[model samples]
Target: MLINETIITDIKNIIAHSKDKAIKAVDHQRTLMYWHIGERIFEEEQKGKDRADYGTFLIKYLSEQLQPEFGSGFSIRQINLYRQFYRTFTNVHTLYAQLSWSQYKLLLSVNSQDKREFYIAETIKNNWTVRQLERQIHTSLYERLLLSNDKESVLAVAKKEKLPSDAKEIIKDPMFLEFLGLKKESAYYERDLESAIITHLQEFLLELGNGFSFVARQKRIHIEGDEFFVDLVFYNRILQCFVIIEIKTHKLTHQDIGQLQMYVNYYDRTEKLPHENSTIGILFCADKNDAVVKFTLPENQKQIIASQYELYLPTEQQLMAELNKELENFEERDKPKKEIQ
Candidate 1:
């Protein structure tokens, strides 16, 4: 005898709901287990006066004793990680259930309490996955926050007390385009790079930082009788505006900036809602001349930005050097213009 269609649908729904509940239960149990382990480790370390050397032999001894009986998840490294995890999060009640072990691990690596809290809140608010959490941490999300907003404002935004005004509030210049996987001096077409980004959209979105959602690829726009295609368009709900992105595999030129400006203007005038903020345009290019960028746009320009795209994550030393150079240039530019008096 065949089941009725309605009955079958009900059964399917029940199974799906049961699966979801089971997953949540498993997650809750895992989180509780880790928290308990952390508590025990903390208590044990406190019992010993010299906690500094407490972890040295603990992992090795535990691994040797537990591996044979309990098997996997008892490695020396994992044991040490548990110790560190305990040290990082002593308050079990404060732990967020939404975040997984991997997310917590990434959070544990961050030294600043405030920064860690910021990431935790954002992760929960945005419903970011473990991989997304890792990417944000690796990209120095805290540092990016510092670069974009004032200390108090950053704190407010991180806590979800205030919404971002525009994409510029979150999108970083010198975008980390390592997801494209393009090698230096490699011969490839622009389409190939675009395809690569499309394939790795998740990574790209993570690198794009927060509040970005893919809108279209090769999005067509019409102005008067002329038609143009934008490489990628994204909508940032937090900002309540459309973000137009143009990808260029070559050095940025005056004409490149002009074209992006047109797109921004078009979105601002036509596509944007009456209450929505102005559309922002990003010119993602292989190279950009800072001097040319400054001269090409008005001093008060806020909508259009030219940024360099890197095909790989830079080493710590390299990132520091790049940041320092940019800071020095900014300071020099900020120096008061000498009076002709």
Candidate 2:
């Protein structure tokens, strides 16, 4: 009887594994099939004198014929998407099998091929879901990269074989925390935001970009009979270090920086393994005094970063204004200081 029970368990495991493999194989095949269909539709559209009109008609006719047989996957809109998909990704071989058709549809909407490729590569490398990919794209990940890095470095980081050391290298400042669903003038406390993040930890991690995994929330540490609580703790596998997040509902202050530095120091000395890199502390504040941030840290500080957090996604105009401000600040900072006699 025991032998029979063991055999049954083994059979069930085999069946589950087989089902998973089969599902993956089907998904892969479906992606390839869609790519091929897209290629064919694109070629036909190119040949048509009135390509736009003809493409619309083709998609409509195809949807009518295929929807009943293939169900929701073959709607007219999706057919149109497939056509655009081919146009966007002419090099079908580069399509990552891990990405679903939904992700490809989102990728198709991005105007820049380089930007699309970057998102695609990152999505595959990080194993981002369709929703996560959409969120990142909507957040203007490409634009953020442009703001933070040179063109060459941006491309390199996007296509690199490995992730970088700093979260700021990938994480966008003024992070869109609208997902927390906090009202702008709600007078919500820091603990409220922290609680939301903990509740939506998975989404938060996705927004945090790649290599982050939850370690703890409100993690307690005792040093020399003094007790302290860290708001959020995460491990970045790529950076090989602990990431300590301190939340502030108000503008950042030098005291906040000092507190975070202490947390980082504690983590580095006690929590971190010998093989791991130094701990990184991030202050997520509703506002940041740039001058305060600049002077509060050492000249070459890399471990601690003070970034503003926004309750909602900024509009294009707001982003542009911020960019202009940053540019002006850069110009001011770079202007040669008058030689002191």
Candidate 3:
């Protein structure tokens, strides 16, 4: 008697799937167990509120007994983390079974409820792995998004309360490319940067934001026997438009903006379907003068965007400094109008 290869393959797949499910089930149960333990600790602490060190003593003593039976998983540090997890996620109903203990641990570090909620929503929607979620948090994705958009708009889109109406809603400015393994001190050509992007394309797409899918590299366009090459091209499903990016290792100039605009026009005229929105052009540069970008494109221009790229991840303080600077600039811009009114 012989068995078919397909039948064996199917049985193997079933076994693999079941094993995965079983692992997930055990992880979820462990999460629940920790939550219940945390809840009990909290209740006990409340009863001993008069003693300042009662909560500390409670966790310390509990860990001593539990560690002897259950090993390091019940260590003092682990027990404290479980307690924090329970307090942070008071409503077990909101705890997603899909998220593992590691993912929840990362979320617990986020201080802001709104920011934590945003990461939670994004983690679920994007099906991000723990590493990916950690990278987003380290890169300050929330702060970068808020650089161009209001907090409400950023969170609303993350939570699916509203669909993104424009590329700016989802696209990040001052994009980080540290994952490309390029040193900040090293100078490279545009082609080098483009190659690095393609090499680490997955990380690039993640950094690109929500719905972008790569379309081409050095896409060629012909106009009256003249040849033009787009550095990189992508389609953003959320905005429903083709996004053309031109990389500039140097500071952005009006010429760079004009060149990007030409590529955008070419895409809109030839590549874009009638049902699709107009093409978007982005000058992915190392640096840019905002005034130059403002005056180069039309005042009402929505199709062209100039974004700076950073070789390294910025610290929270650095992002906050940039945010504060932007706010000051906004205030300066509005002062004249207020005086007139």
Best by lDDT: 3
User: Which ranges in model 1 have alpha carbons more than 4 Å from their true place?
Assistant: 1-10, 50-55, 58-65, 220-224, 320-341
Candidate scoring better on TM-score of 2 and 3 = 3
Best by TM-score: 3
lDDT of 2 by residue, 109-214 (tens): 7888778878877887777878888888887777665655555566667788545755567766767777888888788788999999988887788778777889
250-271, model 1: which lDDT tens digit per residue? 9899999999898888888888
CA RMSD for every model? 3.4, 3.6, 1.9
Candidate 3 Cα deviation (angstroms), residue 205: 0.5
Task: List the candidates' TM-scores in order.
Answer: 0.83, 0.82, 0.94
Which lDDT values do the candidates have, in the order given?
Answer: 0.79, 0.82, 0.90
Q: Which of the predicted structures, 1 or 3, would earn the higher lDDT when compared with the native?
A: 3
lDDT leaderboard ranking: 3, 2, 1
Q: What TM-score does candidate 2 reach? A: 0.82
